[model samples]
Target: MLSKRQSKYFKSLQLKKYRQTEGKFLVEGAKGVEEVLQSDFEVEALIGTSAYLSSLAENLKSKAKETIEAKETDLLQVGTFKSNNTGIAVVKIPGQDRNVVEEKGLILALDAVNDPGNLGTIIRIADWYGIKTLVCSMDTADVYNPKVINSTMGSFTRVNVMYADLKDYLSKSDKKVYGALLEGESIYKTDLTDGIVLMGSESHGISEELRPFVTDPVKIPGRGGAESLNVAVATAVVLDNFFRG
Candidate 1:
């Protein structure tokens, strides 16, 4: 059973301000918590049932600083989910300065995507397509938000998310920039082999500040008249085109 202070501390991780202040975030669900255990991220605590803890590899069980066995009741008490919850972990957020992106590597750059679920789905898509670096404007959804973390499932462990000034990052670069726009050329007609793929928020399209940096503005062709594709759906389609090319 968790003490009052311990429960309070874990509960605080659900909020962005507390997560930032503590330099930690919560990773919920069996897959997500398991991935964090396997990765280089530091796990401060693991809260789960006895059966869940017993199922982990011995080495993985040993890596965590602390492990507290709890029932479904405790999981419900502290987790963001209402049901089907298994585990929740308090883990250290890795520094964003890691130079993981190689020169000429294909990257996904997000503008001001505010939806946490969209951000999470985007991370999963990036992982699915073998893209390792995901850069977002400082205004993009917080990767550590509980919704985003839950949505990633487990891909959060594989993708490196960097927050920076999009304009500053793209303007000084020489690589191709493909901006997905409603009024741009067909993505099928463009070469997406290299450079950054810039996507915008769910409500707003790509920002004007970043337009000057786009080498080629492209869009997905649609026969039916839908207003526009959802950001995550559009990103998946765009990435699929890149894969098909």
Candidate 2:
């Protein structure tokens, strides 16, 4: 069982302020905790119910510094999840290499994407499309946000995300820059692959600063009545076309 002091520590990590101050965050639910454990990340504690602890694989338990048994109510009280179905993991934030991604293969970039759910789904989509490197603008959603982590459903372990000045990165890259816009060339006709694909935010599209760097403004032709496709949905569509073309 987690003590009062420990519970307080876990609960404190729910907010971004504390997460940044302490360089730690929470990964809740069985699948999320399992994925973190499977990765190289260090787990400080694994708090779960009796059934959950018993059901965990031996290798999974070995990854954590300590395994703690707690009641469902206690976990729910401390975690973001309304119901603590399985467990919550206290993980130390892994150090990242902040150097600009070298233009080698297809690198995915996000420009001012503030939605956590969209960010998470985009991470999953990047993983599915075999995109190892992801760059986000400074204003993009926090990758460590609890909602984003939960939405990734474990794909967070596979994709590498970095936040930087989008214009600086785009200005220096020699590779082709493709930005998704409403008034751009058809993605169907464009032979797009092996370069940086910049996906903008839903409401604002690409920022003006980043706009000057886009060498090729690409668009997915939609014959329907929808205003615009969601960022993740558009990313998937673009990647699908890239794969086929």
For this target, which candidate reaches the highest lDDT against the unseen true structure? 2
Residues 1-245 of candidate 1 have per-residue lDDT tens digits of 77767888888889999999999999888889888899888998898888888888889887789999888877877778887446888898887556355555789999999999999999999999988999899999999999999999889888888888888889777888999987889988886677899999867899988888888999999999788889999999999998782
Instruction: Name model 2 segments beyond 4 Å from true.
Output: 98-102
Quote the lDDT for 154 in model 2.
Answer: 88
TM-score of 1: 0.96
* Model 2 weakest 10-residue run by lDDT: 96-105
The digit string of per-residue lDDT tens for model 2 on 1-245 reads 88889899899998899999999989999999999999988898999999999999998998999888899988998898988769999998877653346567799999989999999999999889888889999999999999999988989888888888888888878889999988889998887768899999899999888888888899999999999999999999998887882
Q: What is the lDDT for 17 in model 2?
A: 95
Q: What is the lDDT of residue 231 in candidate 1?
A: 95
* Candidate 1 runs further than 4 Å off: none
Question: What TM-score fits each model?
Answer: 0.96, 0.96
